[model samples]
Target chain A: MSNTATDSSETTARHNEKMKRIKAARDKMMAGKTEEKGLIIVHTGTGKGKSSSGFGMIMRCIAWGMPCAVVQFIKGTWETGEKRLLQAHFAGECRFFVSGEGFTWETQDRDRDVAAARNGWEIAKQQILDPRIRFVLLDEINIALRYDYLDIDEVVDFLLTQKPPMTHVCLTGRNARPELIEAADLVTEMSLLKHPFRDGVKAQKGVEF
Target chain B: MSNTATDSSETTARHNEKMKRIKAARDKMMAGKTEEKGLIIVHTGTGKGKSSSGFGMIMRCIAWGMPCAVVQFIKGTWETGEKRLLQAHFAGECRFFVSGEGFTWETQDRDRDVAAARNGWEIAKQQILDPRIRFVLLDEINIALRYDYLDIDEVVDFLLTQKPPMTHVCLTGRNARPELIEAADLVTEMSLLKHPFRDGVKAQKGVEF
Candidate 1:
């Protein structure tokens, strides 16, 4: 017991010393990184939480009292829990636009889907240009691009020409275009390891939404 | 102009019909999935949003008036934005435990880290058994496991034996063990394609934190 106690104290001392060293190193590293700019964030791949993560950023923006807009491309009709919560809590500061009629598989008509996507893009372009909107979430815009509904070059050019220098934009969906990925400041690909849907478990409220 | 207007209206009608069919199909799929059970969710990979996504779920739980607990294993010292927000807003319904001393690279002492991890596990095990807590987030527990501070078998065994059958649990971190993956009900790996940190951008308030 006595040996154990002594060893524990020694361990604490060592841990403290180690932490001090790390803090010093981290502080030094951080000191060199002072540039701050609005990020073009992309969330893509075949996993859960791509759009959910985008909403998380919206939560952060809300906490900071920043004006934000969300234009959901392919997930409009469902009464999502997030839509209800955000609409109720942050009506004035946030604008939620559901542009897509439904999933492409459901729509099936390429022309109709393209028209809907173009409509959403027009709204998204307006949001991106609005200086009042600090964060613009082009939710599932990548899907529209993936399906060739929206011109990738045009979207990229529009993003590059935003008026406000500090307006952050987040695009969430699977199969982000190579051009978008190249232009993005931060990109997170949510890879799927396992999904409940594969096991016949349907989407759950307050979890999937 | 007349042709364009006519085409637009026709597209809208088609989109509406498509959405109606989707809603019906979705309703039928949802109706068949009536069973509700506790989910073992794993959020792992080298991306940025694993913990952020977990916290988003916490927000959902809060909206539903569910009691939740967070046991942060490897991210204790940082004054994360999520921690501040959750603590302030969901004070009574949530319990936030910062159990780890710091990151492994910072601490550097294996024995000390092990002891700290063990201590956190004790708290987590208690939270898991607590009947009142509906959601328990073991934030960065995988990091502790990666460093061999905690036994994967023991952790998995404990999770499998939770008292309350309805308590959902989320484990977040990179390098999740294969055993844990096999046992998880749902798993998402946040794959990193690009990060501002790689470009020497410092972690920003209300964004990275």
Candidate 2:
């Protein structure tokens, strides 16, 4: 990188003037954004970081001293570093609920999978209703809804209407239902531009988990 | 959710058979994935979760007992919940470094911005070479590169060639340069389908932070 670019006072003055205009516009825009409410955030797409972002949000909630819960829906028994870390570091501050035997194709038992999703939702509902709970991460619940293991309408109704107005909620998974997306306040699609797995590289332990 | 769909023996058999085929194909694909190497992961786009994903990766590293460092480039001195949480829970395991006055348009001083980016890069280089450090998050460095505060080619060469082969790295920001994207192993673009800010909703405290 260039350490210095011949500090020209004349050019600096012009740039400063341009910045002044930008700052004024930005201040005006921000001044209008006065409403602050808990968001129904959806992280869904054919890429990584759906669950990772949820974990990060949980981290933020824990840092700010908010009671949070994570319900890993349609998950496996495999131990994830994120789960271990949250349990170890923020134990009481955050709670974890893991259900299901893995992905749908892997399990191949629709009854068992449906039972698991219902069990997870039971836990999620309790957390969502608890006035003490400030955040809930419905991790991979979209996959359950995709498989018709859970009713999207029922889930959306409880989240958008029954839950406390200030309780933040995040749902993450690939192929999120349209109703859920329509109900979400913020929807971020993590588009997969490139993945190392395509190059015959297995998932790395800490990074992938 | 349907409690049960009348356990049909023939339907169950068909599902089981189809799943077996999928498992076999999945196993064959996984058998070829033997390579294990550090990844240059990039998270960029005009959406949320770029930094959240990076924070989650850092959490993963910490959980797995890997020493990590985070360098917030071109950032203002706003206190983030992620930074505070990392410092409070895993101080010795992870380090935090923040540089720059803020955004390029806001700072309006090219020389000072360049100096700050360079300073952050120097710290990043040290962290990358440190054998003890397993992960480093170059948070918002893309913005610094976008403003020409740091040379993208120089940064890419250092990260791709000089850094330890086993160490993982992540770059987070919107509008990442094409050169950096070319060198990265995994790239996820967080596309903003909907944002609350556009509807006059300010960022939430714990959730957005």
Candidate 3:
């Protein structure tokens, strides 16, 4: 019994020492670390989680009292939970723009969808160039371009010409254009390795949404 | 010339009729649908993007073409562009939990944060209770149990209760209770947020990440 106790005590002491070392290292790393300006991140791919990753970053910034905006293309008519929450909690800190009419073919009005897409793009452009809006996300801009709902050259030019000293831009969607990829400082491509749809299972609540 | 034009017109009319009818029906319903699924969603606010409005839903389900597992328990984090896209793309196919992550001091024990806040509830348990993961997102779970590093009752009970119907599970972090949140469908969270340390400026980065 005595030997066992002694051995346990020794282990405890060693563990405590190791923990102290870890804390010291963390403190040291934090000491010199200063916040840099910001980055423009483009998340695109055929896989999943691109937008989720970007939003996770946005949440962190808001926690620290940041300002931001979001402009989406290709969807309208749905009251999303995110929009509700943003309006309720981040009231003055964020702005949102949805396509407001679903897809062009679904609406049977290519002209209307194009008009909404353009409007959404215009909002994104304003935010991208705004000095006050530190972060601007052009969600699904890639899809809009792919569908020819928005002009790619005009969008790319705007992104390239934005004021670089303060603003950070994010673009999320699949089939990102080569031009956009070339212009971005950081680009991530999500690839689909496996998915549940192959098994013929339907979307589930909480898991699929 | 007249004969040729007439023939072409007749052919085009026949081809477009079927497409037009389908498009019209789709447009009418899609234009007035609610984006989010009505279920027990938990967007528990403690992490950075607990309520970035179901980003996980968009990433795992819509973008990746899978089922969904989503619980959002907070109402904020909507500045970035990703949220808009998710709403537009994944409309009417999400479950949400929208409650703030409460407060910091509410859960501060390392162990408690792990077990109860992270893995404590049966919500996460039921979520990952399958081997056919379509998309599982535990939004803002870290802040719920208060940063307790471990909470046996919360974590163990939930894990024990979990029986994944599919395989994909995601856990977002921000003060992630290591023990509890780790036992997730999928786990990821924001590590950095631009803050005032950069010359007393506000948060920046494509609208905060």
> Which candidate wins on DockQ?
2
User: B71-160, model 2: which lDDT tens digit per residue?
Assistant: 999665667899899888898989988876777778777668788999999999999899998899999999989877788999999987
Between the candidate structures 2 and 3, which one is better when assessed by lDDT? 2
Task: Flag clash pairs in model 2.
Answer: none
Worst 10 residues of 2 chain A by lDDT: A1-10
Which consecutive 10 residues in model 3 chain B have the weakest lDDT in total?
A: B38-47
List the candidates ranked by TM-score, beginning with the highest.
2, 1, 3
Candidate 1: stretches off by over 4 Å: A1-28, A109-112, B1-34, B107-116
DockQ of 3: 0.11
Clashes of 2: 0
> Per-residue lDDT for A1-209 in model 3, tens only?
13497785675465446646666765565565555655556666665555655555554445445677877675466454445555665667777777637544555555565678888987887777777777777777787787666887887787777646566777877888888777765566655434444433343543433
Tens-digit per-residue lDDT, A56-143, candidate 1? 7777777667789999999878777668767876778689998897787676676777889999999998998888888888999999
lDDT of each: 0.83, 0.88, 0.52
Query: Relative to the unseen true structure, what is the C-alpha lDDT of residue B156 in candidate 3, on a scale of 0 to 100?
Result: 40
lDDT of 3 by residue, B62-181 (tens): 433455545543223333344343444344544433333333233222232233443334454554664443455665554444433334455546443544333444544455554543
Model 1 chain B weakest 10-residue run by lDDT: B1-10
Segments of candidate 3 deviating more than 4 angstroms = A1-35, A197-209, B1-169, B172-209
